[model samples]
Target: MDAKGSKARNKGVVACERVREEQHRYHEQDPQMQRVLEENYDYMVKHLDPVMSQAIEKVLLYQPDQAADFLAQYFRGTLEVKNYHYVEFQRQQYYDRKVRHLLALAMNSAVKDRPDDVRLYFADFFDARTKFY
Candidate 1:
């Protein structure tokens, strides 16, 4: 950006950061926020049990005797997916146009869908985001 554009953007960033800080402070002190946070935590923990059961059921159905292996694989899988954006952004930080272009293409292929395709589609996003890792 030119000098004037850069200055305006910096101001906007600073304003956003200050507003976020204020929100954190308000959440820390507000009783309503505290109740809402606690309720959210309770809801999340309550829902997790059924999802965990279903995941284990699905895994066990695939390989009944491989529960231990499944858990090990699950841990590694979560680790990789958790770090995907970090690694992807780092790749962006260091790579040139061609590398980013290839990354985008590979990403698209990984999640590609057609109307006549047998795989699942979604409302929130149009692509199937199944991980091969």
Candidate 2:
């Protein structure tokens, strides 16, 4: 982790280390932001990466339901601690692509098999799976 991030995480309460400025601001349909967060989290943290935060905000503004899965998968990816600010561009791209593919598989499934509004049930599922994150 960078010096600033290290400091934030080291705080007793885990102050968020976020990036608020970046190349893009809003992309409601961006795969990166359109997560299906599996948590019962009432709100987002302050330290989300700027690029990712923009995407998530857009999703929350437009497609709030998807944010759950997007975030849960993102958390899972971070478990390995590989692709981040200093990672090679290609490696980052690969990581993003892999996660996106997984999200697609998870997100699209309930739309057809369930008898009720799949979005709600799927949202619940996402919450159950990622709430610990």
Candidate 3:
């Protein structure tokens, strides 16, 4: 083969090797995350309302991080869908922001409240995202 062609092939091989190495590293790191996810799964199953648990389980089984985003979206949509124009306007302009801010604070409190479960929940969430992408 020409020198240029051989060099190009070598570069491709190196890139492939690098990708494989990165994959291996990720696989190695996954076990800890998996452990966390399993713990969170248990907590969710035990503590959450049945419908909420089912919804979260569906997300965990498919796309866990999406559960939180879905919750956020649902809250936003519900606020938007309210028939009261004044309430809806207040929600859209003021209440929603305060609620979201409070939700964030609540989440932070909850994270501290159950560190292990929170860790697992996040781990599972990240794992699901990584798998999806």
Candidate 4:
């Protein structure tokens, strides 16, 4: 476990540390700009890398004649798809929670031996499950 942890840390954390040291030296002339850059470094790496890396990889593979235009369209399409999936995910989560809640209520009703409550909860659960599906 220790060896694996050290190896993973060496791979990316070392690169991050080296980049920070270089940023400090290069941006020494502007302390404020350096601070801002340091603050955003992690954010850029976390959010931008996945999206930009894919775009760059495709650009390298295709070698488009107009690289800028190709990248522009690629980013637009990517964002559209991402937005769509995000919305769909939210809907799915909501339905899942509703179904789970109804099922839990039905189970509780059964435990209490409340026939009417059990029937109501089960009815609602089946209705939601069918509606969502």
Strongest candidate by TM-score: 3
Worst 10 residues of 2 by lDDT: 39-48
lDDT of 2 by residue, 1-133 (tens): 5998877768834333222222234444354445534221212222223324453443333332234444544434431223222322343454454334434544445433432443344445555645322
Clash counts per candidate, in order, are 0, 16, 1, 0
Rate residue 121 of model 3 by lDDT: 49
Candidate 4 residue-wise lDDT, 34-73, digit = tens: 7767755654455444555675565444543333334445
Position 109, candidate 1: lDDT:
42
lDDT of 4 at 4: 96
**lDDT for each candidate structure:** 0.41, 0.40, 0.47, 0.49
TM-score for predicted model 1 compared with the true structure: 0.25
- Candidate 1 total steric clashes: 0
Candidates sorted by lDDT, descending order? 4, 3, 1, 2
True-structure lDDT of candidate 2? 0.40
Model 1 residue 104 distance off true place after TM-score fit, in angstroms:
23
lDDT of 4 at 83: 21
Question: Candidate 1 residues 1-133, lDDT tens each?
Answer: 5999999999999999999999998877899878867865554356433334453443433432223333334424441223222222233343342133333443244234322221211211212123211
Q: Estimate each model's TM-score.
A: 0.25, 0.26, 0.44, 0.33
lDDT of each residue in 22-103, candidate 3, tens digit only = 9999999899989988876665466433434444343333332233444333323331223212222333444343234433
